[model samples]
Target: MGTREEIAFDRALGALIGGALGDAMGMPTQLLSPAEIKADYGFVDCFIDPAPEHPVSKGLKAGAVTDDTEQTLLMASVLLQSGDSFDHHAWVNALVAWEKDIKARGGYDLLGPSTKRAIDAINAGTPPEEAGRSGETNGAAMRIAPVGILVPPGEALIARVAESCRATHNTTLAISSAAAVASVISHGIDGADWREAIGFAVAAARAGEKQGHWVPGGTIAARIEWALDMVEGCSIEEGIARVFDRLGTAVISQESVPAAFAVLKLAKGDAWEAAVIAANLGGDTDTIGAIAGSMAGACAGYDRLPQDRIGGLVGIDLDDVRELARALVRARLTDEKARHG
Candidate 1:
């Protein structure tokens, strides 16, 4: 492959694999307070299982991914199977099936509140389009990296993110946040620098926020802007403190999305550093780490991921992730070529 294509391939691999690595790295600390994480394991830098007292990830093994990576891979699978012509009904069905499998397997770290509510609605005979209308959490944004890598940076990409998110997170805030993440990933895969990529992400998020069905919440764009403002001239330590202390790491789209962006800003787009820093940030660590890690990984490419972490991921295989990334790149390239030709 040419240098350009090779770079895209590597970035794509980095986004997905680094995302999973970050997910696993933060598993133990997912529900812990920053103080609790500090008390239990000062500065989480390795894969560790959740503590017995942990609310969400308890009983999970070290390197076991939570819902974030699980849903990401599911989305990737559906995206691959559908090619460019995704069927929204099939996508919703896949989500329902995945949820059933998770419940059947006695998965403790089950779906997030927004996703769970949407799935429950589906189970209760609600139509697909209306099932997820009330979801305003970060669930859609957390698992949206595959969509980012699959689509280019444009209105079309934003629209796709909206469509993909509406089945489980239809709110303007949720769709906008998801679009921002996907746009960033798309820019990163296309070899854009962090600042440029983030710029595109911000713009796309604003545009997407205007398009989705309205729900009551602070807009993701405004929150991200506020987060960026908070870190404008602070030291890294201070920036981190500000993010964790004030920006928050909650499951809500407004909180987590901005928190992820704050960590990314603090880490200066270094995938490994971003992931580790995010994992250590306390609340909703895994999801924040996954989001930040995907962006950082896209910017830095796959080589930035730690070799040891890659080796430790429990159920996820790095090789498989790499192969999937390559396949996505090839398919996207083929589609782009066809469109241009």
Candidate 2:
């Protein structure tokens, strides 16, 4: 076995790559129902080309990622450039530039509803803080694995996630959702199994709900437990179906985030299996797949991922992810040493 630092670095890289792999795997089936997905590609266990009629991902080759991976890379880039200091203005600027770049490249980018509105408002000179107050979607949660890589789990993780999410998902549910995903990834990087990580994820969700603008919905923390509890004894197929039908798979933070965790539970922390389940899961497939993938990959480590998909991902840099993961761990270690001293 590797040393603790070596393990953290590998798990951090695994989280990023697994997110991209699942994003690509689910891209074609993103908005389609399970019936629709089955009609088109059957199981969706591997990378396949998006259909010509695909709403968001047509004209791209197999293994091409969608907005989920793009925004994740965007968050990673900003975090790396700024180090421990976060600049809201700079982050907004990056979002604007990303959209502009997308438009320039033929306008096929699938920005989520909350993110699109926040970006438009920010471009029109609204303060980023106020612009996202009403936002409540999984957009924040879908791309927050980078924050997990940067911080260890605890109050610091929750606070950092709030800052990253405030620009596009400022509502209580949204922040809590992101916190759950990030918390899982953080704990996983520290070598916790899904059994231990889920408890921490629930704690983080509760803490995060206290950060953003208050909104009334089923508590994210409660739904995570509820979603997992309902699917406890069932087989993989039954669990995924229960999550899809009962827990939901919509873009709402409450639905999709819990759905991701449910898939993770059924997949038992296997990155490849989680991706397969999430890819075929129907609504918000790419985001759900990416979220589950990050957590599972981090806990399971790099060796457990699908090598074919790792080599197949398009428009992503594995080498860059490797370097970024190392840097993030180094930064975290420095922070810990300073704090203890």
Candidate 3:
């Protein structure tokens, strides 16, 4: 591979591992307020086992990841498995199979509200295009890094994001959030500066908001800009505090997605820093951390992450996505026609 291709490959793998890192780091803290996180874990700088009372993650290990990483990897696998055709049935089947595996392992039920509702809708005979008409949550955006890795920003990325969202997160806010996250990753893989990648993400959000069925919410692009502006010039602690209080850290697409962008800025695009910050930011911490970590990884590549933190991400066997990450970069590098809509 040439220099550019090699770089892309590294960033793609970085996105995968970075995602797992953040997901696992935040697994134990989800649903707590920032104060609660501080009180319980005394600032989550590393992976710690979930509190016994954590509804979904209590039974898992310190470095265990939740549905954010699982769904992202599952989407990546389905994207590759479906080849050029985007087999809808295959996608749904993959989700179903994943859900089953979680159950068999006695893993806590981790499907986000939007995902569960959409799947239920589809199983009840809702049309694919309509099943997720009301899904305006973070579920779609959390699993969208693969699209970013495989497709360039602009119309192609928007179209691919639309396809990725249609069956489970079809609403405007949800699609826009996913596009924003994916665009940042895509631009990072393409060698854009971190701030430049955020610009690309805003543009992608604008484009993506037009694709899915309309839903009432603040414009995702505008929210991202507001988020960055709100935290500009703040120290890391102040930035995290401002984001947690003002921007929110909930599951709504408007809240969590933009909060992630803000986290990326605060961390200066360091995957390890981003994960640390997001893990302590409280509600929906895992997804927020995962998104920021994915973008940071895409911007800087796996080599840039801290060596110590890498050892803690063992619960998710990141080797599973290493080869897949390379294949994605290959698709992007060759201008593969198979990637086209």
Candidate 4:
């Protein structure tokens, strides 16, 4: 019987590994329309040779992760080095350093336009908050799960994560989207049920709404409510199909975030099912899989992941990620004990 600490560590490791696996597996087909993906690959279930023209294809075939996992691990390294505290300068410096490394490696040289602009602003001596423009890209939200794990749960942590998002994604929609996903991961670590996690995610979205970071009128909750109504009584396959058909697969936060949530709900608490469904959704498949995988990993714990898939992942620090996850858990527990003691 594993101890509670061992179980929690496993879950966190599962999430990290599962997230990277999903991302790498789906990278080759990312952003391809469903029809296009079908015509080219016929239900892609594993990482394949990238089309010659695909930017990530070369790296995908080599089992190298894209910016998604790279940025995530970068954040994790920063948090572990910082003893789980938020330091704006240190965070910004980390981002800069990672950006430089990615560029040097020619890996993320062709960065998302918004990310490039934000990084350029930072390089030009702009403050983190002022560095970002009003871009609603998923760049920020896609790599934000580490922040959720590092911070304690509450409005304060939520707000801090949202603000940290301003370093690259300052748009209201982008920030709100990041907060929604981050909140779900945080709630999952706290051992909240799926319903409660969804509720907390909605609350975090509302918190962003309150800060004028969401669309005016109804919030992410309203959108999720509408999405749920659309998929009510539908099969997971049907729901995923409908979302992919209607939303299309793009890297925009608004396009992929809700779709990820829809898949999460449809999975009915099965991490593998949720991740596989999200990964094959066509556009921005990697991002969708990453988001849903994070939630599912938190919900199911790492031990539930298939050892086969975990074994298939390459070009990353699996051991370091596991250690980092355990460290983050320790940091959280230490903080909680201090607060309650």
Candidate 5:
């Protein structure tokens, strides 16, 4: 590969691996309150298995990733196969298959509420597009990295994001949140600076809000803007406290999406710190950490992540994920060339 292409390839790999690292690291603390997290594991600096008392993650080993990485891989595989002609049926099928696989393994970490409800609807004869018309969770946004990587940012791209979300999360806020995350990944892949990437995300989200069917709630765009603004001049601890207390870190897209962005901004593009900070946050830590790690990984590239942390990932091979990232970058380049040439 040429130098520029090689760099892109590395960053893509970094983004995926970094996401996994964050997911695994935060698994033990996923549903804990911030005070509970502090009381139990302290700062959560390393990967630890689910504590016996842990409500959700018990029986899972340290370094094992949860639904976040699994769903992200589902989307990545679909993107690799279909490229710009991505098949919605294929995407939904992959998710359904993944949900089954996770359950068969006796893992309590199954699909999120929106995804579960939508998939049930699809299984019960509802059309895929109508399955999740009211889903407002971060389910779609959490797994949207692949979509952002493969598609250029624009109205069409955001529409495609919303369409993909339709399989599970189709509300205006959900779609906008997913579009924002995807746009950040897209812009970051194309080498936009951290601030520039945030700008792209905010703009794409504003436009995306108008594309999806409306649902009653606060605007994701405004929430994202407010979250970013909240962290501007604060200390890292103070910024995190603000996000934890105010911006929120729950499964709701309105909260998690903006919180993820705010944490990433606070980390200033450092993949490790971003993941660590998100991991320590109360509520939905794994997803928030994964999101931050994904964005930071895209900005900093794979080579920048520490070797020890990469070595600690459970049930995942770094080389395999690196190969997946390479394939994804190649597919994206091919898709871009065909459109712009």
Candidate 6:
């Protein structure tokens, strides 16, 4: 690999590993308010199994990651096979295969309601496109960081991958949410300035909104606008507090996506702080943490993450995620060269 290829490979690996580590670390205390988490565990730094007293905590002891990581791995596998192109059929097949695996595992499935519905529709012979026109869940956005890493920057590229997200999450809001997150990842991989990355993300979100997916009553755009406004006016803590106050514990795409972006902005280039703050925001903690972690990981890279903290995850191998990221970086580079050379 060339020097540029090596750097991109390393950055992508850092992002994938950092994302998983952050996901596992926050799994136990997901969705708890800052005060609630403080009162319970006094600061969640490692992968401690959940206790009986804590429902979300109890699930953690089982070493189970919610739909966030599972879908991410699934999406990565699909993208790897597609060779940096958008193949709708392969995407559907991979999701179907994942659903089968989930069924075989037999306990506490990670497939969300919307994803399940889409899978069922596909099983019933519905086209992949129409199968995913369900509610606007954050499931689509949660697993899309890899898409950002693999694809280049362009609305067309973003839209193509965003449509792949629609194979399960078809709502305009959900599609837009996925694009917004992917755009951030693309810019991060390209090493754009943080402010420029944020601007790109905001533009992507607005474009999605323009497609009529952003409903009238939805507060997602408003909240995102508010977050952007607070960029210069508030401390990270204050900004987090504001997001939590304005957008509560609901896990819908409208609530969670904006909140995740808010926390990402607040973290200000610090992955650990960004993740922890997102985790302590009180509801949908894992998803929020995962999303924020993706952004932070992309910006800070894996080398910047603390060693002691990275050592704490339980079930999954962070090394494998890094390997996948490296492979993906190579694939992205090869494709880029083929197209432009």
The sequence of per-residue lDDT tens digits that candidate 2 reaches over residues 186-223 is: 99888998788888888899999998899889999999
Q: In candidate 3, what are the lDDT values of residues 1-341, reduced to their tens digit?
A: 45987889888988988888888888889899988888888978878888888888877888887889988988988888776656666787788889999999898667888888888988999987888899999999999999999988778888999898999899999999999999999988988767778878888899988888898889999999999998899998899889988989999999999999999999888888889899988899999999999998998887877767877775566567888898888878777545553
Model 2 residue 66 CA deviation in Å:
1.6
- Candidate 5 residue spans exceeding 4 A from truth: none
Against the hidden true structure, what lDDT does model 2 obtain?
0.87
TM-score of 3: 0.96
**Whole-model alpha-carbon lDDT for candidate 3:** 0.87
Candidate 1 Cα lDDT to native: 0.83
Candidate 4 lDDT over 95-207, as tens digits, reads 77777887787665645667778777887998777766555777776777776776656886677676667667776777777788878777777666556777777667656
lDDT of 1 at 3: 80
Better of 2 and 6 by lDDT: 2
What are the Cα lDDT values of the candidates?
A: 0.83, 0.87, 0.87, 0.70, 0.83, 0.70
Clashes of each: 0, 0, 0, 2, 1, 6
C-alpha TM-scores of all predictions = 0.94, 0.97, 0.96, 0.90, 0.95, 0.88
Residue lDDT tens for model 5, 83-164: 5565767888888788778789887747888888888898899988888887889888888887776676777778778777
Off by over 4 Å in 4: 1-3, 62-64, 83-85, 212-218
Q: Against the true structure, what is every candidate's RMSD?
A: 1.7, 1.3, 1.9, 2.5, 1.6, 2.8
After superposition on all CA atoms, how large is the RMSD of candidate 1?
A: 1.7
True-structure lDDT of candidate 4: 0.70
lDDT of 6 by residue, 1-341 (tens): 33776667656765665566657656777757778877877766556665566654464553346557767877887788775356677877777777777667553566777887887898899987777777478888788888878877786656655666767877777777777877877777777644567677766776665442333446445656666665456676677677778766457887888777777777775667766776667778888878877877776666777767666555556767876787777777777888899
* TM-score result, candidate 4: 0.90
RMSD of 6: 2.8
